[model samples]
Target: MMNRILLSVSGVLLLLVGTATLLQPHAFFATEGITLGNDPGLLSEIRAPGGLLIGCAIAILLGAFRQSMTQTPLILSAIVYGSFGLSRLLSMGLDGLPSSSLIAAAVVELAIGGLCVVFLLRLKPV
Candidate 1:
């Protein structure tokens, strides 16, 4: 099902991202630095998100393994993707310099979120 694919893709993305962050937070920060926007301890927050992403990725993979994809998982994944894209858009509009990579990421996130929503709508009662 599309839901399954969405969940798996999100899981893979998150897993790789988390691995990248866990292994090379410095490299990521160097490449795409964040200044906390008047908020303190931004580095700590950046570090914290990685752990959450890794955990969610693992859970998603497990859910897929059980062939248990459903609205809950798909919706949650969509929320994550959509919120991230929305926040990035807002940040770019209000603050933080936008780069090609940032724009590309936002586009992909929005696309995936849209796909998840469409699939959720198309799903039959179960």
Candidate 2:
């Protein structure tokens, strides 16, 4: 169904991004034109959220195959994507514009989050 497809796609994206961040923080950030210096504490801080994002991705992926567990993941998807997208927008306002790639990422995040909201609304009460 559409929900499964959405979750699957979203989960995979989160998984890949999280994995890349956790395993290759410098390389990952470089894509966004961020030059991370050799600071252990900073690297640690940056890597921490990668694990959390991976956890969210796992939960979202679970909902794709589990009929009884769709609702929670839908909510998670909306929260995760919505927050990321909104935060990026806020940064754009406060810190000024970033790279075009980052702007595109924000748009994608918002679109996915919006889809999750739509799917959540369509769910029947249990």
For candidate 1, give the lDDT of residue 11: 83
Looking at model 2, residue 43 earns an lDDT score of 94
lDDT for model 2 comes to: 0.96
Could you tell me every candidate's TM-score relative to the true structure? 0.82, 0.98
Q: Of the candidates shown, which would achieve the greatest lDDT relative to the real structure?
A: 2
Candidate 1 per-residue lDDT over residues 92-121, each given as its tens digit: 889975888889999998988888788878
lDDT of all predictions, in order shown?
Answer: 0.76, 0.96
Tell me the number of clashing residue pairs for each predicted model: 0, 0
Q: What lDDT, from 0 to 1, does candidate 1 have? A: 0.76
* 10 residues in a row with least lDDT, candidate 2: 30-39
Clashing pairs in 2: none
Residue-level error in angstroms, candidate 1, position 74: 0.5
lDDT of 2 at 21: 88
